[model samples]
Structures are given as structure tokens and as C-alpha cells.
Target chain A: MLEDGNLVFAACIILMTAATYFTRAGGLFIISKITPPPRISAFLNHVPASILVAIIVPSLAGKGPAEFISAAITAAAAVFTRNLILSLLTGLICISTLRAFVF
Target chain B: MKTSTNKSPGTRVVFSGKGIAEGFLKCIPLGIGVFAYGIVFGVLAVQAGMTPLQAQIMSLTVFAGASQLMALELWADHLPVLALTATVFAVNLRHLLMGAAMRDWLVRLPPSKTYFSLFFLTDESWALSVREMASGRKDAGFFLGSGLCIYVFWNSATGLGATMSSLVDRYFRDPSVLGLDFAFTAVFLSLLIFFWKGKSQLPVWLIAGIVAWLFFLVLPGKWYIILGGLAGGIVGALRDA
Candidate 1:
């Protein structure tokens, strides 16, 4: 895998593609196959958001001032604007300016 | 007029051209935003060392913006196949709901069209198609049409961004100074906001974050996310029980 980059690259991409398609099709077909209990359903529902929280929290912790402050501001903007792009822009602008001059 | 109810076995759902046209037209504005966002991905893909052909193929096959961008963040000189695929699945798992939600509406269409439409499902297209279906528009082809609009714009913008990447590189040599380092972080933060259900889920999120942070400090790799996510869910289940 390390020696041959292209082959590994193509193989990885194919695997990713398959994984993505599985989620799309699985929900369509397999969802009707087995019924999950309500507790299981609650777990399933909460899992994705938890996963996102897992990804975001570690990312925010122990970061520099610029990145940290920018993230806070971005979260605020996201709550207000609810626009991903706008929130992203707010973070980028804040981080850029803060990194340049403040912190 | 169609209502937002499951079709009876005898009911016929027409995948009409008019539905497709309306879906496509209604999505044009959203598609424009997707195009611009695709450019950012394109530029980032190039920065991550993907050739234009490689990036385009990923875009063509995956056709998912958030997951694709997230994959690029995990890209490396030597591809960590497990990490990359796992991260992609974790991020894209939300699609399962979007897919199941469409079951009532799309199941009435022919299996071929129904399954094909799932290939193009994105957040924007899904939202538009669901709204239309709920608004008495039973045109199953609408989902396909809206997805196609986004597909075209996203691919075109990706190519353009790949070509223009050199210009961006020239202007912004240090990505950190330009705040590009925070791009993925910003995306994730906003996603967290969108996914925030309510104060009820706060305990779940808190446990997930604390567990994830612990593992991130003590261990390596992305497994922290899965472990933390599962732990949080289990906590939620226990809380409810």
C-alpha cells in the first residue's frame, strides 16, 4: 500500500464509495427488514449527534486562541444565521484577523 | 393533488416530466450555492494532493459534500484506508434517515427510478424534494431532477476550482494564516449546531465529548469518535430507561 500509491488510492476510493452507497440503499431496503425496539431506536437517533459531538469537542479543546475564539464565534453565528457557509466565513474572518494581530 | 401520506398499493405515483422540471428549477438557487461550495472542496482537494482526475472521480462517485471534504482532511501521502472509510461512513450515516424518510414517497415510483434517485440524494436535494412531496407534489422524478442540478453544478465548480487552485496557492501560501486551517473545524461546529436536538441531549453530547477527549489524549487514531459516540448513545438509552 505504501509502495504503490495509485492502486491503494483507487482501492480506498472504491471502498469509500461502497460504504456511502450502502448507507443510501440500506436505509431503503434493510430498514423494513428488522424492527428496532424503541430504546434501540433512541440509541440510533442519538448516535449520529453524539458522533458529531465526539468529532467537534476534541477538535475545539486545547486549540490556540485564534482557533478557539473563532470556533466560539462560529457557533454563535451558526445559531443566529443557521447558515453553514456564513458561520464558516465568520470563523475564517475572525481567525484570520486574530491570528494576524491579536493572538 | 397529492398529500403527504403513504400511497396505497393501488395508487399510482407518476414520475412526470413536469415534476422533474419543477424540481430542477426550484433547486437552481441552491445549486448555485453548492457550486461555490464545490469550488472550495476542489481547491482543498488539490491542496490535499489529489490530482484533478482523482478528485473528479471521487466527486462523481461519492457526490456528497460534507463526507468528501471530511475525507480530504484525512487524506495523506499514504492513504489510511480504514480511517478514511470509517470517517466517511460515520459522517454520512445521517443519510440513512434521509433515505428512510423518502421511503413513503419514492417507494411508489418504479424500483429503477426509485433506487437511481437515491444515488443523487444530498442535503439540499432531499430537503427540497421532501418539501415538494409534502406540499401535494407527488412527482417522484422531482428528487432526481433536483439532484441532477446539484450534480452538474458541483462537478463543474470542482473542475474550475482545480484549475484555479494554483492562483489560490499563489495568494495564500500559508493556509493557517489565511485561516484555512479552521475550515473543517468550522464546518463541524455548524454541523453540531444543526444536530443539537435540545437540552435533553446535552448529557449525551457531554459524555461523548468528554470520552472522546480522553481517548484523543490517551490513544491514537479516529476510533475515539466511535467509542465516544457509542458511549453517549448508551448513556442516552440508560437515561430514558
Candidate 2:
């Protein structure tokens, strides 16, 4: 009976929301039963950065020279400034400028 | 350094307007990054066949940047429900650990308030709240406030970006021409640097990046993300042992 694309999309969104909430709340429940070890916490601390690198590396690896240059510029900006907004702006501006004129 | 006025000498947790305001103020700088990322997601969502309303709803409900972007990337006419759900679950599994790490702090709140606040637990809010807790502040309002700021900025920016997508399309024709497609990668990289702890994390980053790159060459879908993250986490755990 659920044949409409709109209905399906709404359902998908609800499902995603439910699934995400489960992860957040469920973690608290699980933690209450047993404390995560120090090693696990250390690993968890590293996971976020690792996941970000994982998400980014594939896209960066297959991209063009402009993408490469812009990524480096962004990385350098992040390293030197330690500011998220500035680094993002650096990437956005650098890539757009390179594409507009150089590429 | 403003202290919460609602706290008594023995009180372990305080939720107050002043703490909320401070948390919101602390989040403003990072909120810009969230807004920029949300705008890109909005533009991409419309391009991927979502109506502006649908995109807005996703932003309001889901709110996690990486998972939402991944959803847009996986969006299609038929709506591959199972695949999309699996990808989202995989990508967001990290929230489990993030929430777990905050259990000591969140456990002090009433269950309703605790879970309600968890709905807005993004990487940015989590990082900020963790730092706040480390500084010996136990105000739950700080967490709620930080999450609220991000939620507002993310949803509004997404709505604006979705509204402006048509204009952007007419002018730029292709998002990649302006390198907007790379925005996700750039944003993630910047965040990774922000969360960088020490030299000990270098191996984890290298291992994850290499695994992800290898999987990108062989895999058809986005399993590489989950695989690479798992590989890095395993190595990190082992290294600690």
C-alpha cells in the first residue's frame, strides 16, 4: 500500500532519525551497565578523527589537481591558525579561485 | 570565567540560563562552520532530487552533518531504503561511543532531559561539552545550549541553501565547477585536525586513510568509510593495549 515516493521518503527520514537516536540513548544505557575501559575510551577519542580522515581520503585521492591544492591550502590554514571557520573559508575560496582562473 | 549561579556548594550538576548563554556564546564560532556545511548539504540534497521541504525536514530531524551528507549522496529515485539505512547506521555508530563517554555527566539528569538532549549530540557539541566538563563545569545546560545553537544554525542554513539551490544552479551550472563538491571533504579534514590529540593518533589516521583509499578502488558503495573507521579503531585500541 505504501507506493508513493513521498511517503517512502518520509518513512526513510523517520527511520534515520530513530536509528540515530538509538545510538545516542543506547550508549548511555549500555554504559550504565558496564564502564568502558580506559583503552576503549582512548580508542573512542581517536575514532572521530579517524572517521573524518576515512571520509575525506577517498574523495581527495581521486580528485584533480585543483582539489589537491585546495586541500593542502585548507590543511595548512587549519594547522597554522587552528581555526575551523578560517580553514573552511580557505578551502572554499582557494578552490573557487583556482577553478575560476587557473583551471 | 563565569560560574553557574544555580549551584549550591554540594550540588554536582547545575542547569541554568547563565550556563546556557555561555555555552551558546562559546559555540558561535563553530556554528559558522556548521552553517556553511549545512548550506552545501542543502544545495546537494535538492540536486539529488529532494524537495526543499524534504531537505529541511532531514536537517531538522537528523541534524548530523556527515550522515546527512551521506544520505544525500545515496539518494535516488527508487530510494534504496535498506542500503541507505545501513550506511547511516554505520556512519552514526560513533555516536554510541560519544554518548557512552558522557554517561557520567548525562546520568545526573532526568531521563527525559538526558535523552532529549542526546537528540542534538553532534560532533561539535560533543567536543565542546567534553571540554567544558574537563574544565570542571557540570552544568547540563551548557550541553543543551551548545546543541541548540548548532541545531538552529544547521536547520536555517539548510533551508536557505535549499531555497537558493535553483539560483546557484542557474549561475554555476555545476557545483563542482566552484569546487563545492569538495566542501564535504574539506570540512571533514578541518574537523579531523581540530580533534587531533597527539602524535599517537598519527598511526590511526594513516591506517584509516590507506584502508579507505584501498577500499575506494575496490568497493562499489561507501562501505569503505565504515571499514576504514573500524580498522583505525581496532589499531588504536591495540596500540593502547
DockQ of each candidate, alpha-carbon based: 0.45, 0.52
TM-score of chain A of each: 0.68, 0.74
Candidate 2 global TM-score: 0.71
Off by over 4 Å in 1: A1-16, A27-29, A77-89, B1-51, B63-154, B161-168, B172-184, B187-191, B194-198, B215-225
lDDT of 2 by residue, A7-80 (tens): 89888988888887887678777876666688876666566566677778998886788899999999889888
| Tens-place lDDT digits, model 1, residues B1-241 | 3223334665456776777777888777567667767878888999899998888988898888878888898898978998988877876775675566565467666667777878888766766675556446666878888888989989987887777888855664444555655766776677678766579989889998999899879865455666777788789888886
Each prediction's interface RMSD?
4.9, 3.4
True contacts kept of 2: 0.69
Off by over 4 Å in 2: A1-13, B1-55, B64-91, B101-110, B123-143, B161-169, B172-187, B194-198, B216-223
Give the winner by lDDT: 2
Question: Considering summed lDDT, which 10 consecutive residues are worst modelled in model 1 chain B?
Answer: B1-10
Per-prediction fnat: 0.71, 0.69
Instruction: State the local distance difference test value for candidate 1.
Output: 0.76
> How many clashing residue pairs appear in each of the predictions shown?
0, 0
DockQ of 2: 0.52
lDDT of 1 at A4: 89
| Per-residue lDDT over B31-120 for candidate 2, one digit per residue giving the tens place of the 0 to 100 score | 766777787788889999988999999888877788888888779888988777777787787677667657646776777677888888
